[model samples]
Target: MKLSKKQARLRRATKFRAKHAEKGVERLCVYKSSQHIYVQLISACGTKTLASASSIKEKNGGNVVAAKKIGTEIAKAAKAVKVTKVAFDRSGFKYHGRVKALAEAARDGGLDF
Candidate 1:
């Protein structure tokens, strides 16, 4: 079966989610919109959001610079919650541009991907 680009990505994402579920580890899911980035640490039990960051105005900054800002925020927030290791979930988006920048910033901020 042929899948459109977006559908293919979603299909790919489903696999990652399944593995993450089985591993039972906190997950760092990244969502990148054309103008914004969002990240969340979902609990292993799948019952709560451990931490999150985004391009929300209160956080400001939405470009590559802004993505970096959110990355830092997510790292700090995760640390505050005592989370050090997490699986990086790219949601099947290609790892470049904003996504890459955010991951790098998160690494710089002390989150092990």
Candidate 2:
């Protein structure tokens, strides 16, 4: 049977996560919606969140610009908490457009992935 789009995306996410888990590094996860973009830095053990940021308060939360802002915010938060390295987890979203912009912005903000 063919999977639905959401199911397909989730499948890909699961596969990527399995590989990431093996490295046991902190995870930088990104989730985007129609009106918001959320990011989190999860602990290496996967039991806690070290830092988080979102675009909920932005005038246009779903755009690339908002995503970039959120990325910088997350990077700053991670630095404040002394987290400099993490594995980027795009959550199965294609690394394009807003996702790409966010990743680049985070890099500029001093997070190493």
Candidate 3:
């Protein structure tokens, strides 16, 4: 049977996460929705979120601009807590459009991934 779109995304996410688990480093995870983009810096142990940022407070959440802002915010937050490097986990989303914008902005903001 063919998997639905959401199911397919989840399958990809599971596979990505499995590989991420082996790295044993902090992870920068990004999740995007129709109305918002969320990002989190998770501890290596997967027990804590070192930092998080979202477009929920912004007037526009569904745009590349908003994604970039969230990425900059997340990078600042991570640095304030002394987090410099992390694994980028796109949560099964394609690395284009908003996701790409966010990642580039984060890099510009000084987070290495």
Best by TM-score, which number? 2
For residues 1-113, could you state the per-residue lDDT of candidate 1 as single tens digits?
88899999998988999988988789999997776788999998778999988897844455788888888999999999999888999999999888889899999999897
Candidate 3 regions exceeding 4 Å error are none
lDDT of 2 at 98: 88
What would the per-residue lDDT of candidate 2 be over residues 51-76, giving only the tens digit for each residue? 99999899999999999999899989
Instruction: Tell me the TM-score of model 2.
Output: 0.96
Query: Which regions of candidate 2 deviate over 4 angstroms?
Result: none
lDDT of all predictions: 0.88, 0.92, 0.93
* Clashing residue pair totals per candidate (backbone < 3 A): 1, 0, 0
- Model 1, residue 47: what's the lDDT? 84
lDDT tens string, model 3, 1-113? 99998999999988877888888889999999999999999998788999999999999998999999999999999999999989999988999999999999999999998
lDDT of 2 at 105: 95
Shift of residue 104 alpha carbon in model 1, Å: 0.8
Query: At residue 57, what lDDT does model 1 achieve?
Result: 80
